[model samples]
Target: MQRKVLVIEDSAVSMNLVTRLVQQAKLMPICAATLTEAKHLFSQSNPEEFLCAVVDYHLPDAPHGEAIDYAIASFVPTIVITGRLDEETRTHVLSKEVVDYIPKENTQVYDYLSRLLARMEKNKHIGVLVVDHMRSSRTSMASLLRRHNFETFEASSAQEGLDILHQRDNVQLIVTDFKVPDMNGTQFVAELRKSWPKEQLAIIGVSSGNSALLSARFIKSGANDFLQKPYCHEEFLVRIMQNVEYIENVETIRRAANSDYLTGLPNRRHFFYSVNHVARTSPALQSVALIDLDHFKRVNDQFGHDAGDKVLKEVAKLIANHFSDHNVSRFGGEEFCLYFANVAAEEVDKSLESFRRAVRERPIRHQQQDIPISASIGVTHQGRKNLDAMLAKADELLYRAKSSGRNQLQSDLLA
Candidate 1:
C-alpha cells in the first residue's frame, strides 16, 4: 500500500510545491487548502493511511495553529511550518509532540520540509541500534529513534551490541556511547568493522566529554560520523539521516549496475556472478536453461520496435512467474537464461514443458494489438563439469532447438 502524506497549506504556490516534492519522493500526497477542507479529506480517508503530515501553522479557516493541534490530536506525526516562529508558538508546537517545527522564512524552509517528508517515508523501514552503558542514556536514544518511526535495538555494553548485530541481520545504523563496558567506543567501532564494512552499515559515536580528540579517535576507528553527547534533536536526526541516506544510495547504485533496464531481470553479468556463488556453496543438483525468442526480429520489423519491447517485457514476466523460485536473467536482446537451484534430472522436462506451454498460451497485448509470442528453450542438468561447460552444453542444444524447429524445448537429458 502507498503511504499518503497529508499537506495542509493555504497558499496555492506552497501547496503545489509541496505536493510536487511529495510525489517526487514517491509518496502520495493528500492536499487541503483550508482547515475545513482538511477535515473533509480526513473524513473520507482512513487515518492509518497517512504516514505523516506537513501542516502550516496558520490557515485561512483556522488561524493560530488550530490545524497543528487537530493534527496532533489525530495522532499523526507532523512537521509544522509557519511564516514566523516565536517563543509561545514554539512552546505550543513542541508541547503537542510534533516531530519538528520549521519557520517558513524563505524558500529553503520548503526544501527542509521536503527533506523531512522524505525521512519520514524512509524511517519506517530502517532499523537503528543504540548502544550505551548507562540505562538512562540508552533509553533516551531509543526513545528518540522510535519517535522518528525507526525500529530500534538497545545494548547496555559494547560486547552486547556486537552480539545483537550478529543476531539481527537487518540492523543498518548504530549509535554508540564513548564510554561502554567490555570495550570502549573506539575499540567497539574497530571491532564492528572486522565484519560489517562502512558501505554495508554505518556507525556513529557519541561522547559527553568536551575533548575534540574523542571525535577524531572515533573516526579513526571506522565510525562514519561522531556526535557530542549534549546535542540538539535536529542535529542528531541530521547526522542519522545523512548516514542512512548514504548507505541506501550505495545499494541503489549496485542494483542499477546489476539489473537489466528493459526487463527488470538480472543482467548477464549478475547471472554469471550468481552461478559462481552457487557453485561454490551448494552441492545439490541444479539446472540451467538458455531461452531464445523465436522470430523476435520479425516482431520488431513488422510491428515496430516499441511493440517488440512490449512483447519482450510480457515474455519476461511470464518466464519469471513460471520459474519464480529460480534465478532468471536477460542474457541479451530476446535471449534469457534461467537457473534452477535444486531439482532432479527427471523433473527438468516437466518444468520446462510447463513454461513452454504458458508462453504459447499468453499473447502480448500492446496498443490495441495482440501479438503471438513463442520461445525455444534448451536445458541442461548439471554434470561432471564447471558452470561454463554446462552453459555451453545448454547453448548447443538451444541451437538444435532453433534448427530443428522454432517454438520448442530441447534438453540434454533427452539426448
Candidate 2:
C-alpha cells in the first residue's frame, strides 16, 4: 500500500504522532503545519508524487474552506481534521464540501484517517468488463483486472454483454473475446456503435486464436484497443488504462472544438460537421433548419446582457424540451439550428408545428414579468445531393421566414 498523503496539522507534536500513524499504514506522509507551507509544498512537488491530502482547518494563515478549496482545485481528495474547536465550528468546517471531516482529539482519528486513505488508494483505478467465450478464460481475465484494483465484470458471450450493459451502467470499458456464440464480438460492437456512446467506452477486443487481421478488424468496428490473450497482467493493466485515458483525452479535444461553454449546447462547428456527416452517410430523408429568435436585440436592450443570457438559455431549454429528438445547436448569439435526420419533408412540418406550439405555450418570466420570445425557422429537406447545398437552401428559407414574418417557418424560405 505505498500511497502518498499530505498531512496538515498545526501542532508539531500531533504532526509527529500522525506522521508515525501514516507510516505504520505503509503510506508516504507529507506534513504541513500552515496553509502557506501546504501551498509551497504542493507547488514544489510533482503531481504524481502525492495521492491525496489530509488538511487542517484554522491554519495560522487562513482558517477553514480556503485550504479545502485549494486542495480540491489541485485535484486531491481532502480530509479536514481539527481540534480545540466547538461542534458548531466543526460542523461549519465540514460543511465546506471537503471529502471528509474529523476531530484530532477524538480517540478514533488515526483509525479513521487510515481507512479514508486506503479507500482513496483503492478508488483511483480503471473499471473493466471481461467477455470471453469460455468460463475459464473469463475468470482468468477478470482476476488479472482485479489485481490492479479494477472493479471487473464477466460475460460468457457477446449477447450476454448486451444484457450486461442494461444491468450495469458504471462500466466505462469492455474487453471482449474475439470469437463468441450468436454474434462475434466484432459484429456485436458494430451494432453497439449505433446506439452507445462511442467516446465514453474504451473497448479492447481480445483474441487467443489466430491473432492475425482480427485486431485490425476490431479497431475498424469501433473498438479503441486490442489485447492478445495470455497477456501478462502488467501489460494488460497498462494497455487498459492507456485506452481509458485516450478516450477521455479525445472527448476533451472534441468538446474544446465542438461545445459552447455558455449554454452547454453544441456549437456551430459541431452542428455543421454532424449535418454534413449525416447527409453524406445516411441515404434516409432528412431536414435542416436555421432558427433565430425574433427581436432578440430588443430583449438584450431591455433586460441587460445578463437577463438576455437568461432568455437565450430559456429559449434553448424550450428547443431542447420541445424537440428532444432532434440534434440542436447554438449558432452564436440568439441564433440556433436543428437537424432531424431520417424524417420526411411533410413530417418536418408537423414536428415544427408541435415545436412552435410548445414554445408559444411556455412563458419565460423574469423579475415577475413575462418576456415573450418566438423564433423564425427556415427549414428544407435534402432532395439535393450534398450537405452544403441543403444548408444553403435552408439559409435561404430562413431569410424568407425572418423577412416575411418573425414567428413563422418557411420552406425554400431563403431570398
Candidate 3:
C-alpha cells in the first residue's frame, strides 16, 4: 500500500509547507486545519489511512495532547511541532508517543522532519556503526555517514564491531576497510555472516592497492560487495548507492510485477496501481483517456503478427510521446490508457486530436506502402466513482468513437 502522511496544522502557510515536504518525501498527504476536522477525516478512513503524521502541539480546536493522542491511537507515527519546545516541554513531549518535538521556525526543522520521515519509514530508528580500529578511520567514516543524515556509531576493533552489531539490529549497511590490526577484515565479515545468515546485515568491504585476491576472499567470507580504497567522492557515492539501491529496486519491481513486457508499458496491474496512486496523491482535478487504434483487426489480418508487433511498438512510442506527463499504460492488447494529472476532459480532447494528427502524419511502412493509422480516443473526467466505474464510462465512449467514425475523437465530458 502507498504510504500516506497527514499534516495536521492550523496555519495555512505552515500546513502548505509541510504538505509540500511530505509530497517531496513521496508520501500521500491529507491536510486538516483543526483537531475536530482531523478526527472526522480519520474516523471515516481505513486503518492504513496513514503511515506518519505531522501534528502541531497547539491546534485551533484542541491545543492539548488530544489530537496527538488520537493520531497515535490511529497507529500513525507522529511528529509534534511547535514554537514552545523548551526543555520542560521537550522532556514531556518525548515521553509521549510522538517521534520528535520540533521548533517550527528553526532552519533545522527541515533536517529534523526529514530525519523523522526516514526513521518512520524504517518503522524505527536509523543507526550505522563504522567498524575500524584506527581512531581516524572510525571517526571519518562515522562522521561522513552522519553528515549525510545518518545516525552513526563507531566501533574501534573487530571485537568492538561484533559488539555493536549484536546490539544495533537496524544497521542496514557497514563500510569497513581491511588492515584493521589484530583480527583483519576477512575474519570480521566471516563471523558476521555466520551469525546473521539470511537476515544478515549488509556489508561493504574496503581495501587499498591490489586487493583482487582479498576481494575474492571477502566475498567468500559473505560480504555483499567491496570497494577499493583511494576511491574518489563520486565512486564512493556510486558504490554506496549500488549496494543500497538494489534493495529498493527489488521492492519496486516486485510491486510492478504486473507491468507488460512487450512495450514496457504498464499492464492492467500497473494501470490500476498508478490509477490508485494518482487518485490518492494528486489534489487537482484530472481525466482519463482510453485510446484504441482504428481498424486494428485489419492490420493484424493483412500483415502477420510480426508486422502487428511493429505497429504496436510504434503506437506505444506515440502514446509515450503525447502522454509523457500523464500516467499512461497499456490496458492489454491494442488499448492504451492515460490518467492526465490535473487536466480536464475537455483538455484531453485537444490533446487526443493532436496525437491523432501526429500518428496519421507518420507511416508504419507495412508491405513497402505508407500504411497510415489513426486512433480514436475517449476521455472522461474524475467523478465520485471508482476506477472500475470510470473505466466503464470511458469504454462506452470508446465504442461510440469506433462506431461513429474510426478516426475521430469522442469524449464523455459533461454532456
What residue pairs are clashing in model 3?
133-156
Model 1 bad stretches (over 4 Å): 26-45, 59-66, 85-96, 282-284
Candidate 3, residues 1-415: lDDT per residue as tens digits? Answer: 7778888899888888788788777788888989988888777778575777888888878777577888878877677887675777666665675555677767677765764565456522456667776788777666445433456878777787778887877776777778766688878888777776523356788887494698888888888888777654435544554555454456567656866778877788778887898788744776777889888878888787777778888889888887888888888788998877777666777888899888888879766766678888777775556778878888888888899877777776644
Q: Mark the 10 consecutive residues where model 2 has the least summed lDDT.
A: 118-127
After superposing candidate 2, which stretches have Cα over 4 Å from the reference? 1-127, 131-151, 155-171, 174-246, 282-284, 413-415
Question: Ten residues in a row with the worst lDDT in model 1?
Answer: 89-98
What lDDT, from 0 to 1, does candidate 3 have? 0.74
CA shift of 317, model 3, Å: 0.8
Model 2, 21-91: lDDT tens per residue? 77876789888888889889888877577777777777777675577778878877667777745878766
For 37-66, candidate 1 gives per-residue lDDT tens digits of 998998899999988888998898888889
Q: Model 1's lDDT to the true fold?
A: 0.87
